[model samples]
Target: MTEKKNAAAIRGPSDHTIRDQIVAAAMEYFSHYGFEKTTVSDLARSIGFSKAYIYKFFGSKQEIGEVICASCLADITERLNAALEKSPSATEKIRQLFQTLAVAGCELFFRERRLYDIAAASSREHWPAAVQYEAALRERVLAILLEGRTAGEFERKTPLDETAMAVYLVLRPLADPLQLQISLDTAGEDANQLAALVLRSLTP
Candidate 1:
């Protein structure tokens, strides 16, 4: 984690690295100050670059903000996928998902609260990526839930899509206007509560 943090908070990028350090500095600043309040000059100065350099990389503050959100979400989806894969049971899988979200919040918020805030505010702009990520996550969850149902681990009459949507609804606030950042412990419990509620509704 320390290495990853160091990698992100750095001077410049390697020829092979996909990320740009100038953008990293800008994102860090924006996360702290917010998109509306942050300026190109501030981001440029922070990274020791001219404002022209910043504009060369990102046309506007909004573009920089959106790109940062995309980068964060891409990283987050990887963590979420790992969490779902490692859990021992469907109930635990749900817990893992929330815990992953909490960890993501820490990484994003500790690094840049404003990035998460800005992303939350302009979700529609990134809706296509968001939808793709959600579909992939939901499919994994649905498969596990179906297995649990078959094993009598969970009870449910709700369609898989509906159940998955319910789970998304519970956690969606983590990303948006509600912008609720939670501890890992709280996120885990919230996941458990949501899973339990869904299961109880399905109980015969």
Candidate 2:
């Protein structure tokens, strides 16, 4: 086994902590320099560690990006879960979700846009973390849909999973920087119109 892996095996508690340090450093580099331009060497130098040492925890730059993006996804999931506890109608919850994404998501993913490239790259690479993140997103949507269906707020004719996936896809572009940039002025109107359409479709 690799020395770093061997060391991690010996110190189980510290293993994940040390890896988090590397991920934190990589996020800084990725923020300053787009993911395509940030090299493993840059990340190593930033943390005062050898490139080989960084590899002990992360196999590649893509893995670092994947992990970081996954964390972001997880954070989003937590917020959504917290909102779910308020027991809002599923339609209202979904409407609030789209509004939040249209505004906050655009601001973070487009206006700030530092880590946007990493997310896009992760999607392109088809990394497992990227896939997991998407599944998590779909799951969130699914939860909302199932809740609405159970409450009789939504059409029973539609399949829950497929409807959830459709909702995710429909709202995805509003959060996409490229799409937002192309038609910035109309994004708000577009988001509202789309949300209305989706919510209308959900009503029985």
Candidate 3:
């Protein structure tokens, strides 16, 4: 246990506050720098603590990582809401959804994505808040699609839940920054045409 201190555990001055302080610092570090480069001691140094202080709060680096992952989940939920504020029309809201997703896939949000993917790959059955966060995101988007339907902006015959999920699946891969930059640039030539592909399919 003591060896962990020297190995790279973060230890802070206070027994109670250090843990949360370390976790908060760790969250920002991992979010900005990514998982590969972030170290336990790095987080400790940020909060005026030593490596052992961190281990006292979280048993292992993996444990610390779990907390960061939860933060990422929360971030995704917030990003979607933030994106909605940028637009007024239901049609425009859909575009904002993709734009926000693209931003979320960038360097800023990539750290959380890395953890989300890791948990998904390792524990398919349970991923704690990470999975719930995704489900909640899906629901947010579905609600928007349903709103469009109510306004006669979307296809009326197609079931709102099924169509929203289908569109999410098709657009998920395009959420990548590389794909976004390319598709959005191309989409400019057509004006929401990227969404049109999914929309038409849902309607037809």
Candidate 4:
């Protein structure tokens, strides 16, 4: 028992490495068991370290959930940016953005139901990281709209910023996890049709 406890107490080579491991392990547990079910001691045991070690990196389990939520959104944003880079037209880019977000949101949020719980908790906790990610999302949508206007792919009857905001709001449901799930479950609306409708609304 003494040897076992000592073995669990061993730290990783460095703080960064240890922190990454903790986050990675937490992600697995959170995905499989859920944020509410996973505990600090559980995480520590999984990483072969003490709860104190996890504390050295994260203040609490909620912090780990926040990081996971933020990381998931960051990944989605990267995919959206990549879609923009590869597509030929602003219209195509807009379509790609919706498709990308729809798939990514479903995979990330729906793949693990617990992630949705974490997201909800983060919202209630007022985690600024999630809020910042959403703000960045709005900005990216605005950028895509401005690009479309410049290329004459889309018309802007409203002010540029207003139009962008409106577009974001209108299309947001398709990307929202709960809304996306509901739409898929009840309406059987795939991402392709959804993307097309959004693109059609902006057609010149």
> Candidate 2 — worst ten consecutive residues by lDDT sum?
1-10
Instruction: Give the runs in model 4 whose Cα sits over 4 Å from its true position.
Output: 1-14, 123-126, 186-190
In candidate 3, the residue pairs with backbone N, CA or C atoms under 3 Å apart (3 or more residues apart, or in different chains) clash, namely: 9-51, 9-52, 10-51, 10-53, 10-54, 11-50, 11-53, 11-54
Q: Give candidate 3 regions above 4 Å deviation.
A: 1-16, 24-56, 107-126, 174-193, 202-204
Using Cα atoms with residue i matched to residue i, what is each candidate's TM-score against the true structure?
0.67, 0.79, 0.62, 0.78
**Total backbone collisions, model 2:** 0
lDDT of 2: 0.70
- Candidate 1 residue 8 Cα shift, in angstroms, is 18
> How well is each residue in 1-204 modelled by candidate 4, as lDDT tens digits?
011111123334456667668878888887778888888999899879899867766777877776677766667778888888999988888778777877777776557778877765665565765566656668878888889888888887868788778777766766555466566553224656756776787777
Better of 1 and 4 by TM-score: 4
Candidate 2 ranges beyond 4 A from true positions = 1-14, 110-112, 175-188
- Cα lDDT tens digits, model 1, 59-127, are 567665655655667688778778778888776776676667766765666566577676565465654
Error of 1 at 51 (Å): 4.1
> Which candidate has the highest lDDT of all?
4
Determine which window of 10 residues in candidate 4 has minimal summed lDDT: 1-10
lDDT of 2 by residue, 1-204 (tens): 011122223322348778888877777877888889988998899899999887777667776776676665555555555665664688888876666555654555764367866656666676665566556667778888888889998998877777888999997776544454555567777778888999998889
How displaced is residue 195 in candidate 3, in Å? 2.5
